[model samples]
Target: MSTSPRGRLVVAAVLFPLILASCTIDPSTGPVAISSATSSGVSLPGATFPSGAPSPTTASSPTVDTSRTTGSSAPSSPTLPSTTAVPAPRIRTSPADGADGISPTAPVTVRAQAGTFLRVALTNPEGRPVTGAFSAGRTVWTSTEPLGYRRKYTLTAGAVRPGAPRTESTSSFTTLSPLQTIYPSFFPNPTMKTVGVGQPMVIIFDKAPVDRVAAEKALSVKTVPAVKGSWFWWDDRTVHYRPSTHWKPGTEVTVSANLYGVHLGGGSYGEADRSMSVTIGPSRIATIDDATKQMQVFVDGRKVKTFPVSMGMDKEVTVAGQKISFVTPSGTYVAQEKYEVKQMSSASYGLPVNSSLGYDSRIPLAMRFSDGGIFVHAAPWSVADQGVRNVSHGCINLGPAAGRWFYDNFGHGDVMTVKGTSTRLDPSDGFGDWNISWDKWLAGSALA
Candidate 1:
């Protein structure tokens, strides 16, 4: 409506101010601030102040747009921190190369992270067992036998994950320097003999041995009756054997042993088994009296012969212990060799008559027995001292032919008893094993 010049002029003035305010506003910049606490008025650069400084005043209620929804997911998102990192595996053994030795003493062990074990084996260049021994434990693997002395050997081992098949790893390394020359002493000496039952086979080694199982296996005792027997190592040097019970008087027994490469009880090895033959003789019993210095010889309990034998003299007193050892059988004996008078020099006998009743002295015998030195011997030089006295050391002094007759009849286990001596008898003496009381002899034998 056209109100007139004044009314239109008034409306133009008010509208003109509003138009100037809009012109000064940055249309592209939208608003100067959208905050609720503060506001400023905008005016054209050429416009003049309408009133004073256009003082700001707080509005009790203000109009604002609140119609749009602006909640949406952001394009770039936040990430979390990690706690673990992987590690590299390791190698522990060497030839550094995957090579092996001509002979390896042990398998190469490789330690790596993936806590699983691998296969390690010894092989010849041809991939054979290589004579190797291996050991296995809860968490470790090792070799059992020492590697072959001079052969080429290879080792193959591997590691795999917990549930997977074991992966193999191979390492090639030669064992240290070659083995040294070893001189073994456990074997038996070259000179030894195998014996029969009558012989009471005995052995004396140079050293004590600890490998008893081995030593026993090396020894073999066989007989038709299949007698039970054992080997007793009396001392470092001596070992004796006997039947579980008394040997059958006429039964032949064979004893053999091979200790040439045997390891005895200790680190020592036996030299070898020696062989000897014992002729079983008819059983006989002999009795003697210390007070009388007399010997009664019986065959199967019948008195067949008598002999005057001397007991040990004062200092050379006869051994008082029982002879439950190597028993020389009783039989007629011949003077295999003898001397009417010969020089003797051992400290045991008073006269210079060193006779081989069943023995051999470095010096030739003044008298002799059969194979072993238990003889009815002579001492022509002691002729005056013969029958009337029991003065000769433990031997039966007789006329030469009498001794030969004794020798011709006597063999191993031929009983011969000597009594009436002041000396002592040790288990080591050979006075006819029966010389000792039967009870005591039985006590000495395990089966008795």
Candidate 2:
């Protein structure tokens, strides 16, 4: 159609915008599209124009997109990763699998690795918790005594390893009729320490304790002015309390043995509380060394007298140790002084006389070694062999002068020591004092 110049120009500008939109836009029928409004009207780019229009042209479609489009295309929705949670741990094995009808008297136990603070509870058929007669320790928990006769017990325990999620474990135990009544081991039993200057306080128990380590801890002792001391467990049933050194003269000493209700081994228990007082007497310590063949007496840490003495032969040397043990079985015998110049016969002595183990002495001396054949008699023949040379069977020989000195000075409880030799002290041999250090002695104890 024919038109004025100004109107024609306006139409040309509008046409230019519509054609440009068609080139850059996408088709709405396919994956994407763009729409624009102009004076001519709304126009859809990247799509077919109206048929028979002033200009009709077909354009190629955009490459189809398989992946979903984002902004400026279709809508986009947020996505979240899949998720799940972990569970807790549980016990794997228990007492056992199905067995048979079990006895009710049997004891039940629960155990686990350390640091698992487990709370255990037992309940009856009616769901009531059995609370009394229960005990527990660092590694174990058990009934203080036997459980009720022929009773059904349900136990539940809950525990958690450090930093682990809390978990629970449970089991059931049926006890048969009571066959034994095991008593509970009790603590904090009463204690008594002896306090006397001359007393060696001792604790005597009816039952030997099984755990000496624990029992010793229960005992306590202290002097008015504290002294160094230790516990000597004579046996499981008895313990002696003594100072490292003897008590100082005139010092007051007290000792106690705290043992009660502790289950000593062999189905026994400790006796009543024990306390003793001791009064230290004058210092009396004697040392008899085979070396130099002299006996030195000491009082209050000062030497007093020295005496010459005879000793056992190499075949029967005195034991080697600090103290001299007089393990002689006490008995009496008449002193026999005679001259047996001729080779003595075994038949000369009364009781199964064996001259082999005894010296055929002519000068009589009464000696005491064993009850059967014991005597401390004169050995004038052994005078030259005293000291330097090891001679005279097991009996100690003495010179006439020194013998009389010892005979006159000696009294009951007067210190006597015999040391130096190759013989080892026999455990049952009582002839030794200070034979071993207290620690070494304690090491030999079964209690240790």
Candidate 3:
């Protein structure tokens, strides 16, 4: 509509103020309608916009400013590179980051969520790889065996999303150091081919272990025939195993000391693992009755022969006003060593051979059992007392005929059981393990 210059000026002034308030001009984005709240896709140059929203544009439609648009025909914002859909999973480790004083047996584990484990590498400070296993789903890895004490270990784990690069994470920890370490020294000495069926397996420790329960639990025994047996502690430093009855002849037995990594007690742990196997020989047993003054021999459960013998003195009153008796100890024993002719003297038992009550002689047919100087040997001097009275030192005195027979027929590892003596065999004396009752034996077990 044509209007005078003064009327046109008035209309331009009112409309220009309103238009200026609604639309704003910018150097980078050309123009935009300013609002109290931001437009859904509107943003400055190089500024990031939220997902599902477009970038800032001129007043026509929301579009990115690839170049300043002077008209309504602005092109669609250059399709933003497709946003990352899902991030790769992260790795997490046990003994998180840098830990210390870990147990040697505790597992070092790595796991992932919303992803799968690609690699799990655990190594010692020297970079030696530790052995481990992966879970069925491959989402976790754990150590298979025990770690070393006072050692530093490093762990690195990698995880990946379905189509993402592997992401790695690392951690480290140290195991606790033991205050001490122990090892077992058990018998049949690891060399004997055959042992008496009555012989018990004995384990002697270098020192008393701190945790007897753990130490005992670490030991095991397996017989080829699988006979039932149990372990008993004779003392803090020693343990023994035996069947309910004597082992069967020709039975093969194996003993394992799986002490390594076992916590022994206090701060002590086991040092190493050990194993031994032995065989049981023929069954041969000898029974002696101090009251009857006789020795009965048995072979393979059959009674063989009997011989008249003399045992230790009932009592002897000495000049020092001391009543001393050379009573033989009564208990089960094994013939450990044999001698065709062994020199016998009071000096061997810490007595003066020259003394009036002592004698020195070369005794024939000696089978020694007790660690003390006790033996079943020929003592012809006491022949008159044989089968009648107790008249020798602690030796089981036999006639020349009987002694020679035993020396020729009795083999090493044969059993000998003494009865009716007032002096009981000490559990630690010779092979007197059978003297203890089964219940008493079991009571000594740490597990009990």
For each candidate, give its TM-score against the true structure. 0.42, 0.39, 0.71
TM-score of 2: 0.39
lDDT of 3 at 52: 20
Q: CA lDDT, every prediction?
A: 0.39, 0.40, 0.70
lDDT of 1 by residue, 260-300 (tens): 43334433434434544343456554555655545676775
Model 2: per-residue Cα lDDT over 1-448, one tens digit each: 8899999999999999676554433222223111110001011111111111110001111111111111122122223222231122232212221212222222333333332324555455555444322234322233222233334455554434432344444445443222222222211122322211212345655445666665676577777667776666555566555565556666766555543333333433333335555445556554556777765766667887765656656652222332322222211111112121223322333312332453343444343322223233355666787656656544556676655554444322233445665554442232122344667655643445
Model 3 collision count: 3
RMSD of each: 32.0, 29.6, 16.5
Q: What is the Cα root-mean-square deviation between model 2 and the actual structure?
A: 29.6
Candidate 1 accuracy as lDDT: 0.39
Ranking by lDDT: 3, 2, 1
1 or 2, greater by TM-score: 1
Q: Find the candidate with the highest lDDT and give its number.
A: 3
TM-score leaderboard ranking: 3, 1, 2
Q: Candidate 1: list runs displaced more than 4 Å.
A: 1-198, 244-246, 258-262, 265-279, 284-286, 315-343, 346-376, 381-387, 430-448
Candidate 1: residue 16 Cα off by (Å): 92
Question: What C-alpha lDDT, on a 0 to 100 scale, does residue 53 get in candidate 2?
Answer: 10
Instruction: Give a tens-digit lDDT track for model 3, residues 1-448.
Output: 7899999999999999676565433324422211111001111222222222111100111111111112221222333323343444655566555466666665556666666755666776666666677777777666655667677776655556554334556556666677888878878878877887788898889989977888888899999888888898877898999987788999999998887767777877777778898999889899999878899998889998899888888765354454445788888887778898888887665556777777888888899878877798887888898999987888899899888898877755678898999987787777677777878877877898
